[model samples]
Target: MSKVKKRIRPTKEQAQELNRRLDAVVEAGHTSNLYCDCDVCQALAEQAKLMGYRTDVTIKRPSDKWDRRKREYERRRQNDAVKMASLAGQGLTSAEIGGKMHRSKSYINKLAKEFEITLATKKRGRKLCH
Candidate 1:
């Protein structure tokens, strides 16, 4: 037989206190663009737990399309193209590197071209020597 789980609920007074604190936190966050995952918000979450409240919260800053595009590009820029090129220099084909790195062969080719690394194309299942 499968075991059933029990739920723990807060008492009335604890619930009231938790609600008051949560409202204040939400109100402050709305005006300040405060994200829930930040350190201050996380501390507020811990405080809520200590006060007998369990809550899940999420908050985000507003941004336009340009801001979103810039953030995406910055995130993509963190990839290790230099390391990819170094791996290619060690006689690994784009497909092999893609397999090892969990990336597509086309992405490997793009990185190779962007970094000026020459990849040797050979027959399937055959590796080229540098």
Candidate 2:
């Protein structure tokens, strides 16, 4: 038989103190700092966790450096796709395009498929003697 654990409820004074601290933290614009390792924050987190609540709260803020880097990467990828499309339009085979772009034939094929650019498929080998 498993023994059941009794949940200890907080007293009225403790509940009021917790509410006051929470309000103060919120009014001080420290909600984002709730995940801090400070004594008060840790105590509050522990209490909330014991109450069957989530203690880890995250507030997401936009990062300008990350956003700028992402945009730059996207721009470079778009430009590469355009270049690949133009190269395909010039009747270059996948292997030739891969060599020129310093990429693999599979990469060229994937890019062609992604950009909806049709690539030429031709047989390349030594000519057979009759």
Candidate 3:
């Protein structure tokens, strides 16, 4: 013989307790939505819907203008890296390049390393005769 399992339902008091907890969560979602419409609040609203409650919360996404500005900034940075690599290939010291580009010598050296460019190093003091 096959055994069948019956489903157990919550009692009246347990149901009331569950409803109170759901209401508390929904209230918290409403408060969070008032401050910021972030992912956490959106998840809470979805949870309320799954628990048989309706919510009017909406999630806000980043604007297209912000994404465009970020992409432009990255493009300019890559162009500058190419320019720095060309300048390094021309046998110019980092200090000289920094002077021409109005950037710090350390900044130029960092970019050169990042772009795998070899820079010219200046020799200091007098050379000894063999």
Candidate 4:
């Protein structure tokens, strides 16, 4: 014969005690939501919710404007473009410029095109100069 096991549930007193422990932590002040998965912890959360305390955590957000941040990033990109142009103008190869700029050769080429810059040689001799 197979026997079935029954689950044990917390008594009302146990539930209230769990609630008091959780409420005390919240009352002492926690800024983030406490994660509860255990039976006692979950029961405590339910109890505090019943006692009128918000168990939900509030998330803080950054105050910076997205538009302003985007503009700043664009300005940084433009500055990178200027640096790349100057480096290329000084006989630096596209690969060298890319290495210095921490970018791929393809990305450097794209940036050069976008900024109306060229990767042509700096001088008329030796058939080469980047």
Q: Give me the candidate number with maximum TM-score.
A: 3
> Model 2, which residues run further than 4 Å from truth?
1-60, 124-128
lDDT of 3: 0.71
Candidate 1: C-alpha lDDT: 0.69
Residue-level error in angstroms, candidate 1, position 38: 36
lDDT of 1 by residue, 1-130 (tens): 8985444676788677666766776776743654456655665666665654444444445658868999887566446576677777788888988888888989888877876778767767857787
Over 1-130, each residue of candidate 2 has an lDDT whose tens digit, in order, gives 9996565687787688679768766766768753455555666666666564544433234658977999998897688788888898899989888888888899888878888889887878999998
Identify the candidate with maximal lDDT. Answer: 2
Candidate lDDT scores, in order, read 0.69, 0.75, 0.71, 0.70
TM agreement with the true structure for every prediction: 0.38, 0.48, 0.50, 0.41
Tell me the TM-score of model 2. 0.48
Candidate 3's residue-wise lDDT over 10-105, tens digit each? Answer: 467755755665576577666544445555565655555444454454545656897799999879768878888888879899999888888899
Better of 1 and 3 by TM-score: 3
lDDT value for candidate 4? 0.70
Task: Please provide, for model 4 over 11-118, each residue's C-alpha lDDT reduced to its tens digit, 9 standing for 90 to 100.
Answer: 788677765776765665542544435444555556555444534433234556876999998998898898998998887878899899898888888888898887
- Screening candidate 3 with a backbone cut-off below 3 angstroms (N, C-alpha, C), the clashing residue pairs are none
Q: How far is candidate 3 from the true structure (C-alpha RMSD, Å)?
A: 15.9
Q: In candidate 1, which residue pairs clash?
A: none
Report clash pairs, candidate 4.
none
